[model samples]
Target chain A: MTLAEYKYADTIHRCFRCGYCKFPVNWMDVNNCPAYARFRMETYSCGGRLWLTKAWLSNEIDWSEHLAQILYSCTACKNCEEKCPLRFNVDIFNMIQAARAEMVERGLVPAAVKEFLENVQRHGNPYGNAREGRGEWSQETGIEQYQGQDYLYYVGCVGSYDTRAQQTARTLGKVLLRSGVSFGVLGSEENCDGNEVNALGEETLFEMLAEENVRKFKDLGVTNIVTLSPHSYNAFKNDYAKYDGSFPVLHYTQLLRDLITDGKLDVSGGMNARVTYHDPCFLGRWNGEYDAPRQVLSAIPGIELVEMEKNRESTLCCGGGGGNFYTDFLGGSENSPARIRVREAATTGASVLAVACPNCMTMLEDAVKAEGLEDKLVVKDVSEIVGEVCGIG
Target chain B: MDIIACIKRIPDTSEADTIKIDPSQMSIEKGSLVFKINDWDEYALETAVQLKERTGGSLIAVTVGPKEWDDVLRRALAMGADRAIRVDQDMVAADCHSVAIVLAALTRSLPYDLVLCGAQSEDFGCGQLGVMVAEMLGVPHAALVVGLQEEEGKVRVDRELEAGILESYTIELPALLTIQTGINRPRYISLGGIKRAMKKELQVMSPGELGLTAEMLAPQVKLERLEFPPRGKEAVLIPGTPEESAEHLASILQSAGIF
Candidate 1:
């Protein structure tokens, strides 16, 4: 492909290797980018990846598996966009995504990525599990199929299929029930939110998913959506607008925060523990809703919320974004972002590492076990923690 | 060197729990199953594509199945096959010999210096179709081919045997080889590539088009009822201290004559 055919041709060369994209918001270290942290190589950083993308587009370098790896390694965490001093910072993530789109168009990508997209295309989930079983997680939990209810409890692909995440999904359902929220779940009828699909640069596939989901939601008369995953919230709140899917969507944490403040749910059964919150990139940076989760955690009686060095806008990703939770390009290393984040959480002396997103929950939970910090640290979803205090589930 | 690759589509039964004997009692339930190119067939296609890349020849992917099987053919075309052909048939219940007859007839009609087939299908796993086709076509053939290299007028291949042993042979042109998995890493078929493949040559023909009838392609073997094996005893966990568990395990093994 030539520069003329590339989507980010004009601004592709604008990244002059500023190097700020590698640092956290506090500029503590140059390991903010998860890929860069894992490999500690310039080629894995956001700016380095852009340079390689420019070279590949300009024909200076050929498209190899390595090039695809570098580009796909980005978590789309918006960390560079958060820290870059340039005026074109907003388009940086888009530029990388465009490069991935080119690779997808050329029929070249990592094998695992291909499997991920195909699974989503065929089975409506990345696990390639039977779609008939998507609603099985809600079995015996009394969650009903969506029927023009007040809210559609959108348990995304992870919550629907992943065993551990399903617990959080059920817990959140019970919490909503305890709050007496008029909500129903799509269950088997729910499709992928396509956040990771769009991030992975499968534009056409993402469009198909977005269009199908919008049609399904509209047909069901869904006006309000509360998603179990921030990834779905990002897609529904921002990406779905292009398809005229303008439903009022809330990440479950946002709803929980409101419920606790309004006394709709009782959390008076206090649990004594020092807790640290890990800001999911989609929730904190992509959508800029940093206060909701923190507010919810603070409202719980006797719970002490501590701040890690990297929190909120500058928080490091769990290395699970951009389909990396499945592809896992940045895994299996001590320097992996999840391991680093867990160690950071351990340093805060918090026994609990609280996560709001299912992707974060799975990634960090595994990282804790891998780091062998299971004794000192435990990973719990915000919903699970709230469920404990609320005496639900 | 024109290449012909025989591929098949099979239901994904990786999640073994999902497999259930259908009401027909002759096949597994496929209503909720997702399908994909047979694993070994994908390796065969990759090997063919690689050979065609090196030898500067055309690759054609062929399958014998219903219209729904065009998907695997499209995947082959996306993986750089010049053309694809599907012989319309629902041979899922047919024996290996019958399917091989249809394949041999189709192979006879195509221009092929080399014919490739997956050693087995994921569904049936007969491991006999490719050799049977070669026998009918009257050509030199190799089975369980784990490695391959092209020469001027022949190809050298390594056939896998038991105990990790490899047997090598140099077969002349117009030969057939049943591909084993791990011969090559199959390239991923992108959605864009699948869209492009839609414009490629995908010809659909019937068994009669190849001058073969049902009687000519009748199976010598017949499939009986399909049933799951009876469940074995549940695992027994020895619950005690390590030494006590070890003593109990020794007594159990002694009782089972494992000593």
Candidate 2:
């Protein structure tokens, strides 16, 4: 294969292996990349993955399951983009995604990734759950279907299917009700936001999903969307524009921040608890809105908001981005990024680990259990926190 | 060698709660249900595709269903099947013997050294279609095949038996095999691949095209009725701390004579 065949051919060779992509903002450690953190090898780091991608494109290496696992293990957290000192740092994550696109085109991805994508393709969710049951979580919550509402509450796949994430979905619905926003949900009609599909490098499937969703939204006259997961928010705000799906989208935290500031919802029934917020990579580094969730948490009376050592732009990913939550390539080890992140949250001495993304909620919740820190830390979505303080369900 | 794989499309009823008996009492309600290619047939397609990859051959996928069933054929084409053929018939209510007759007639018209089918449909695990087709085609066959390897004019296959036992046999050319799950991991069929496969050859034929008629496709065994299973006792939730819940569960089990 020639260099002309690859997307980033000209800039691919510019990486001199500076190794800073493996470190957090504080430069305290070389394990910032979740895959690198799990394997403790240079091959799993951003620089290592870029080099491997170059080799594979240039025919220096053969495609293997091990190589696919290495490439798919990247969480697309943008921590490398956050920490890399090179001018080409912005394209680092995209380069990896491009490589994955090549692997996907060759049908050479890992088995679990294949399962994940197939599930999403067949069932409109990663769990292979029935699409008929997508709206069952909102049955008792009294959330109406989306119909020319001011804001279409777009709960992505994880929030719609996963058992635990469903609670956050409902809580956000209840919280939205308390805020008196003219919002409605898509319910069973909602489709996968295709954020993870794009991240996983299935560009065709992603485009199909985006086109279908954009058509559906346009038909429904949806002008605004507030998403439960930052993954969806990032997709709608950034990737969907190419398909003429440029809607005014907000992460739920940003909506809640405005709701709190405008006194639209009362939180006088606040309960005392020390909380530390984990910035979802999509919301923080991917979109740059770190202060909204913190401001919302700070507005709640009797709640103490703390920050972990690696917060904001340098936050440690829970290893759930880029479809990793479902594929789980970085799972089943002490060195897993979720386990490492919960440990970091625990070190801050905060009892509550507040998260703004449903993916983070599920990942860190399981990590807390695996690390046996259930008694020390509890993972709660920021919407659930606001629901409690506002005395809503 | 040329291979022909038989596949079926069935409603995804994995979620038990979504299943409801239709008013006709002969079929389950599919109003809100999603459909996919049968799980076992996916294994068969993978097996056929792998065999074709190993030896130079054409893999043809055939299904007996209505036009809505073209989705599974497209998926087969996406999984590297060289061509697809759909016998336009609604065989959902047809007996396995009748379906087998249709498949046998279809397979005879094509040039194939080997024919593959899933051990059974996920909705109805009769496990008889492939063997019946083999009998109608007058060829040697194996069922519950978990492993397969191709040789000159013959193939060796491992058949899974009762009690985790495996039986092996070598069948000569022009044979059939019923593929079991875990035979091979099916490759992921990307939407892009499926889009490309849409441009491939997908031929539709009536039963007459295979030289078959209503008389030859008569069902030998008939489906009586469909009914939901009786609901058992509601599960008792033991709510407490772990130790307390464990003790409660133990006492409940002890009282129930579960030891």
Candidate 3:
């Protein structure tokens, strides 16, 4: 909207609008693009959207209601960007969403995205609970008296508040205890990392969150951030720089892997379940962290690690990206595709479903439960698995 | 000790092209997925190699994927996995639960003192298999292991607990463990390791080889849809200088009763 803003958008101008970013032409099967899959329209594809951006810039297409809908229709999955010949980044889709969100704030936002944003701001979470006890998992563990010193584990909003993901937090704590790494947690005062706000293009609220967190980190002398959620990691890794706050950022998987390799942690006995891993979009695609968690799985004796058909770079969206976890959409069920992903992992004949990010854990766990596969498939975090195996009871 | 590290091949997440979605016609675009080591598992492999050097163990790497994953397995070998295994089949059923079943079965067929994995894979985020495998094998397992020491006929581990809390556990040998980052500095596979891994054995398996079946892998879960979360509007930036910003922040917090 401003000259400076135009300069920022210029970096994205090099996109050739080629659709190759989402899929290769030689794909023998499997039609990609969830949006295109749903709508059967080029406007929903990354190429079409990129062209729309170009059109807006060239004044060929006015920024109108139609344009706003086209922008909002994107899930910000960034999958389309992969197939583009020029590798045009699809984060622009998110940027467009953010820009439109700004207009929506001025009573210009289409009637569509209004309720979802309101819920997040009011609830301090997307799930619509004003007094959502985010740190309830820590309470359930009954490990209330342990005063740890080496690290301060920050379970993002999803991990702490989301009931499904809380199991991961508790499991992580238990695993860390078994491994003997002194760590602490903020029983309270851990607010949202402003990730959803920031990603929603609400830079102002995001900054408020950044400043507040900087204050909290400094107040607590927080030297390191151990997060279980990649969404939190992305916010910490990329957005924290905006506030000039730098700390050692490690996904819980990365840190735990290091401990296991250093002769600081040990495993005893073996397991009899075939297992596969699913990569979270933020941890894998948003950030290039692809090794630590699997390495941990592979380190165990007698266990086999398997890959999914859509894995790592080619992973399917669990319908939770860009705060989709909180919104209501009439499209296909959010839990079905991710459940299908879980089934893909299940198809490997592995008994356990492994994951890293809390959001993914929450979504997939629900999918598993919804599909009534709880008895056949057990959902566990890498930390919980390791904790149980460390022989600490 | 010969250490077999189980790894996985996955899509590259940071690059935009790697993610896929089922289209209207149920067609997946080709090459949209770029394969790599499962993000967390790569860290596990690096950790295993490092531990092998320090504690004296041979690192064997393994993964279950179509034969296309041989390159990634080879890359793991290049990264210092002494040996690699590939479950080369259409692993559509390789969800957290089914994969665990297969892995548990395969591990029973081999001999190992320890096992390691990333706390969770980046995609699924289930974070379960490590413990579930331990449960299935009846092995004592630990996650978030930041420290470990093998002593006289026993293993001692310092786990990274939540809230910065820690507790120590000691276990007997022949156990499974999933790793967390920051436990140790994972070493990059030197060119020598890569070349050396080339000489190592890389084996493959099918569901039948692992005694697995689709009936046993009935997906207990399903994702109904994938869509962007709703958004209301842009944040109202109450801009000011730092001091003014603080004052304004205080007012907002006060108004919201946060302070």
Best by TM-score: 2
Residue-pair clashes per candidate: 0, 0, 199
Instruction: Please name the candidate that would achieve the greatest DockQ relative to the true structure.
Output: 2
Could you give candidate 3's per-residue lDDT for residues A311-362 as a string of tens digits? 6767766656666565423135533446656667777777888888776777
Model 2 Cα lDDT, one tens digit per residue, B1-259: 7999999999887677888899889988887778888999999999988888888789999999899999999999988999999999886474898898889999989999999999998988888999999999999999999999887889999999999899989999899999999987777788898999999999999999889898887767778899878889998889987889999999999999999
2 or 3: which has the higher DockQ?
2
- For residues B1-259, write the lDDT of model 3, one tens digit per residue: 5566777766544433334455642333335344556767866776677667677867767766677878778767766666778776544432677677777777877777777777787666778878787888888888877777777556788888789888799988777778776675343332223445678799887767877786876656555554434668998787876679989988998999887
- Residue A156 of model 3 has an lDDT of 76
User: Distance from true position, residue A27, model 1, in Å?
Assistant: 0.9
Instruction: List the candidate 2 regions with Cα displacement exceeding 4 Å.
Output: A1-4, B92-94, B233-259
Every candidate's chain B TM-score? 0.91, 0.92, 0.82
Task: Using TM-score as the measure, name the better of candidate 2 and candidate 3.
Answer: 2
TM-score ranking of the models? 2, 1, 3
Per prediction, fnat is 0.38, 0.53, 0.00
Instruction: Give the TM-score (vs. native) of candidate 2.
Output: 0.95
Q: Which one wins by lDDT: 2 or 3?
A: 2
Sorted by lDDT, highest first, which candidate order results?
1, 2, 3
**lDDT (10s digit) by residue, model 2, range A276-303:** 9999999999999999999889988899
